[model samples]
Target: MSNINLKTPVDPKDAYVLVVEDNVSNFVLIARLLAFMGVQKCEWKTTGWGVVDFANTMSRVDLILMDLRLPHEDGYEALKQIRTDPHLQNTLVVVVTAHGSSAEMHKAREAGFDGFLSKPLDADRFPEQIKQILNGEPVWDLGI
Candidate 1:
C-alpha cells in the first residue's frame, strides 16, 4: 500500500466506514487505503446480503463504499434497501465500481448514491476524494 497524504485531514478514526465488495483484492486495497487514511472503524461485507445484515447490527455508519456487482444481490438493490431503511437512510453510500461511463454515473445518481468513484482508484487523490465526500461534497471521479 502507498502512503497518500491528506491536504485537509479529517480524523478518520472518528468515522465508521462500511466497505461492501466481493473481490478480495479490491477489498484489501480499499481496506489498506482506509487504514492509511487513519480510519479505525472500518467493516467489510463480501455480499450485498451481508451488508444489509451487517447494517442491521451496526448502530452508526458514516459512509458505505459499495461495489456495483456482488455474489448475490447487486449494489443497486442493496443501496435502495439501505436508503429506504429508517435506521440507515441518512448514511452516506457511494458506488465504487469499474463501470464509470456517463450513463452509469447517471444511473447511480438516479439510484440515490451519495457519490460514485471509479475503480482502480487513484491512490494519490483517494484521501482527498473521500474527505470531500465526507464533507458533503458529492464525488464523481470517473478516473477519466
Candidate 2:
C-alpha cells in the first residue's frame, strides 16, 4: 500500500509507493531507485493474491507498480479488484513488467492501468517518472 499524494502532492520523496513483484532482485533494484529518489515509505507485496486485502492493511496507497507476471493471479486481475474497491478506486496503478510490447501495452491500457513502464526500469529515468506520475502527468513508456 502507498499514500500516492497526487492532489497537491507532498513530495516524491515522501509518497507512499507499493511495488508488487515476485522477484527479489527486481524489487531490490526498484527499492534502491526509490531510496535514491528519497522515497521514505515504500511497501512490498510479492503476488497478486490478496493484493487488495493487503493494501487495505496500509494507511495509504499513492501508487502501485505492479508486475504483469506473478505466482498467483496476473496483474490484470489484481487491477480489476483494485478498480472495484471503493476505497482504492481512485488509486494510481502502473504496469512494470519485462514483457513490454505494443500489444501488451495496448492490452494493459484497455484493462485500465493508469500507466505503463517497461522493465528493466531505467534507474536514471525512474525517479523523474515517479514524480510525473505523482503529479498526474501521463507516463507510458515502453522501456526504450
Candidate 3:
C-alpha cells in the first residue's frame, strides 16, 4: 500500500501533485508556479496512457492536473482509470485543457473532473487557482 502523509491535508507545501500534460513548456510553467507557491512534491506524465499505474507507484498524490489532448490516450480515459481506483478516489483531478470552450468545460465537469482550468494559463492567477484547489475549494475558470 502507498503511504500518504496527511499531517497537512491539502496543503500545497506538503502535498504531492501529478501533472499529466504532453507539452513540455506548459508543464514547466506549471511546475515553476507550484514551486513558487512552495509545493515541493511534483510528478510529470506525458500521456494519459498507464497513468493509473504510474500513480500507483507514488507514495502519495494530493492532486492531478491533466490535459485533454495528448499523444496517445486522452485525459478522459486516464480520469476514468483514476476515478475507479480505490486508492486515488479522494485525489483531486483537474482538467487543464487548451480547448477552454464552454462545451469542453461542461464535458469535463460531466466526465467527473473535480475542477477545470483553460490553457494559456495566466501566471498571475494560476497560483491562486492551485491554492484554492489545494484548500478543498473548486476552481472552474475558462480563463476568460
Candidate 4:
C-alpha cells in the first residue's frame, strides 16, 4: 500500500478533475484521494446534469471521476453527452461506483468510460489508478 500525501504539487491548474457524485462522503473520499495524488484543482458536482456543459466550459479538464448513480441523469447518460460532444470527446472519464459487477463494468465500457473503480475505493489503489490514467495508460483493468 502506498502512502499518499494530500499536498503534492501538480504541474498545471488546468489539469483539473471533475468529480460527479451525489454522496458527500464519497465525494470527500475521492477529493482527498485526488489531492493525495497531486491533483490540486478539482470541481465537484453533485448531479450528473450539466456535467457536459461544465466540462465544455473548462479550458482543460484532464479527467472526470463520475459516479454511476446520481439524482438527475446517471453517469451513463452523462458519459454519452461528454463523448458525443466533439470538443469534449477526448476527455478521459473513470466510472466510480458502489455497484461493482460484471454487468456494470460492461455497461461502463460500452459508454466509453476510460476506467472503472469499485467503491469503497481503496486509498492505495486509487492513487495508483490515477497515476496510470495520467500516464496515458488504458485505465480499465479487464483482467483476462
Best by TM-score: 2
lDDT of 2: 0.88
lDDT of 3 by residue, 1-144 (tens): 212223344777988999999999999999999999999999999999999899999998889999999878999999888888998866888999999999998888888888899989999999989988877777889999
Which lDDT tens digits does candidate 1 get at residues 109-129?
Answer: 888888889999988999888
Clash counts for all predictions: 0, 5, 0, 0
Question: How well does candidate 3 score on lDDT at residue 46?
Answer: 99
Write the number of the candidate with greater TM-score, choosing between 2 and 4: 2
Quote the lDDT for 81 in model 4.
89
Model 4, TM vs. native: 0.85
Question: Can you give the TM-score per candidate against the true fold?
Answer: 0.90, 0.93, 0.93, 0.85
lDDT, candidate 3, residue 128?
88
Error of 2 at 118 (Å): 0.7
Off by over 4 Å in 4: 1-14, 141-144
lDDT, model 4, position 15? 61
